[model samples]
Target: MSRLILRCFAVATLLVPVSAFAQFDIEREPINYLKGPVSDPISRLQMRLDEAEVRLTFDLKSGYLESVLKTLNVSETSQMLVFSKTSFQRNRINPRTPRAIYFNDDVYIGWCVNGDVVEVTAVDPQLGGVFYSLDQEEVDRPKFARHTDTCTLCHASSVTQGVPGHLVRSVFPDSVGNPILSTTTYRTTYQSPLKQRWGGWYVSGTHGQQRHMGNMIAKSSREPEAFDVDAGANVTDLSKLINVEPYLAPHSDIVAFLVFEHQAPAHNALTLANYQAKLALRDEEILRKMDKDPDAPRTESIQRRLDHSADLVLKHFLFVEEAPLTDRVQGVSGFAEQFAARGPHDKQGRSLRDFDLQTRIFRYPCSYLIYSAAFDGLPSELKAIVWQKLHNVLTGVDQSSTYQHLSAEDRLAILEILRDTKQNLPASWRK
Candidate 1:
């Protein structure tokens, strides 16, 4: 089958990487996803709670949802509503009462009406996506526990490049909120076609002429794709379709949705790069020890692995394959302004968060997540390769057709922005 499947199977049997093949055991190896020490947002919050430094107040209506959001620094306006029965609490989510997701750069919080627990996911610098659940019941102490057993079944699939990460999926859901099995489902990304996006999600925004599969339900299981997507287009309000009073926000801002589609996969790419580099380096160490040469040159196989992983991260961080927008997209929840304002701007007053809704997602076409902890936490060897690749492309040294999307102006602007904003950039970048 795939190389990832081979790696998993090899790891399962050998518990270590072989001559050319490297084992990827999540538990015993470099990436101890579940057993390793975690410094994610939720884990740190737990430490504060144990130390009596913070208290999460619970309310009768939404339990600890509001307090948790405030504590986690996840804005309420970054909310997205999904009516599909896709989550662990799928039974509680439907067209009438949907599940709400709020997120910031590093953390995502999921809540449902009358749901048993508040789902939290934190992007650990080293561990990728770490899942946790907070109980709804009010007790003397509220704790967030790692919920890996169930979460990893879907998160750590081929979709996430065989790593623990998050994703956004679109499916044709029936009236009661069950996805129609006969129809096609999509794992949405920034490169996804607009017409096929947001099938079971409530999209609240305005886009002229362009039609998406949001804010509507499949009338028939047999003819799930027969519905007119135009009816869902230009939807500025989700209150008519579902009870918005229960949720923290009234709208599922399309801008936020668009950003999420890009950010989720980018996180997965970073995590994959991190995991692959660490594994490759460990294997290299083993080889060096066998040869009894402390200064042995890295194997070609190990070097290729590092380069490939860095290339993946660079492509995503630079938004190489982002789909161009056909029409001007606008959001009602003001998430765009809020997101753009939270920036590490250069002297030119430009940030990667600046949107180009008329033609593309971001104005500069570079991902703002370049400044994030996840990106910064990448292994030095992998990060160095990524930096070099970025330098080559940005400086016009590599004029290969693969990066023809970046114009001279775009390249110059991005280079300047990174030089001013990114602290850990290579010293040569400053020159």
Candidate 2:
């Protein structure tokens, strides 16, 4: 009977589940997934920015600002928060503390305030996201507001009716928004530290008052040539009035909003380009997905193609700095030497010279510089994608042969590819 009981106990032990054997036993401590060094404030700020859904359109990390900061040797201590009434204004006021009073559009009255930042218990009129700082620190306000009267007098005539915001006039066939061309109205009035009439978009003009030289008499409505002055005194050339290109009031309100209000980096041509590229890619992706559905009916393929073409054109504009590889060398011999040094080996263990007699062609350094520079300004996410694309090209894993060849036709093809590729990218890339 004892032997039988022992056999039963052994059977029960063998039948017990593995989980039951470990029952009541303490589990090993979880791996510290969040372990490591604490991140710095700037890194924290970047993470917050990502959380806030701020699309850093340009590569902010290695951008022109970084270069400028390096050249100036301007430390963080040297940075000062300043508010200038106008781009032409020489005086800049410290927003942290105020000594005098200024016009307040909200109350329609000028009052002397102790500081630039005012606590508003009342509801915000715009961007009703609560008038508070993210860091729980005091909210510093710019001296000027976007809805100010001085700003509206000139910008009101803008394409957006004085919105003083980015004028998204029309989406090109490729889905990129072409910035509303600055008209005579914008040039005549609206002054800002940035707003230039030339260089397509994003003010490339020097920040200053426009100097109007004179008017052509032949183009004038009134005949100033026949006008005479007092006895023996010459009449000032009526045809040549020194009319300054209307010092259109600077959109200080917009500038202030971009800089202090949003705490965004200063708007530049590069930023504008990045914004356009993102928009274009978005449009292309939507169209491509729509085209793929056979059940959706044979809808506007022509329109889609047109849009694709337009995107290609815009990409060309964005990549205008990339020169053709062929243009780099004076002759074929110099090109060959450079090509041999770069080593374009094929899968068949053959060099570029073995496959093509014209292996002497050199790659354009300027093109590489432009491509690399563009990647530098992109946000971290997009920068990673750009880096990946570049890596593929360098490894010959990607068909960037058209871009490498440097022919006009190849350039256009590469532009199209770039547009399509950008469109297919995830939305996270833009952010």
Q: Any runs in candidate 1 off by more than 4 Å, and if so which?
A: 1-23
* Deviation (Å) of 182 in candidate 2: 15
Candidate 1 residue-wise lDDT, 1-431, digit = tens? 97567555533533333222322467867888877889889989999999989999999889999999999888888999999999999999999998999999999889999999999989999999999999999987799989876998888877777788897999999998999988799999998988889999999999888889999899889899989888898988787777788888899999999999999999988988899889888877766665679799976767878888888888887777778898999999989999999888999998888889998899998888898899999999999999999899999998987788899998999999889888967899989
Count of clashes, each model: 0, 14
6-100 per-residue lDDT for model 2 (tens digits): 54554454344322322111111111111212222223333555576332221222222222223223222112111212111212222211111
- All-Cα superposition RMSD per candidate: 4.3, 22.8
TM-score of each: 0.94, 0.23
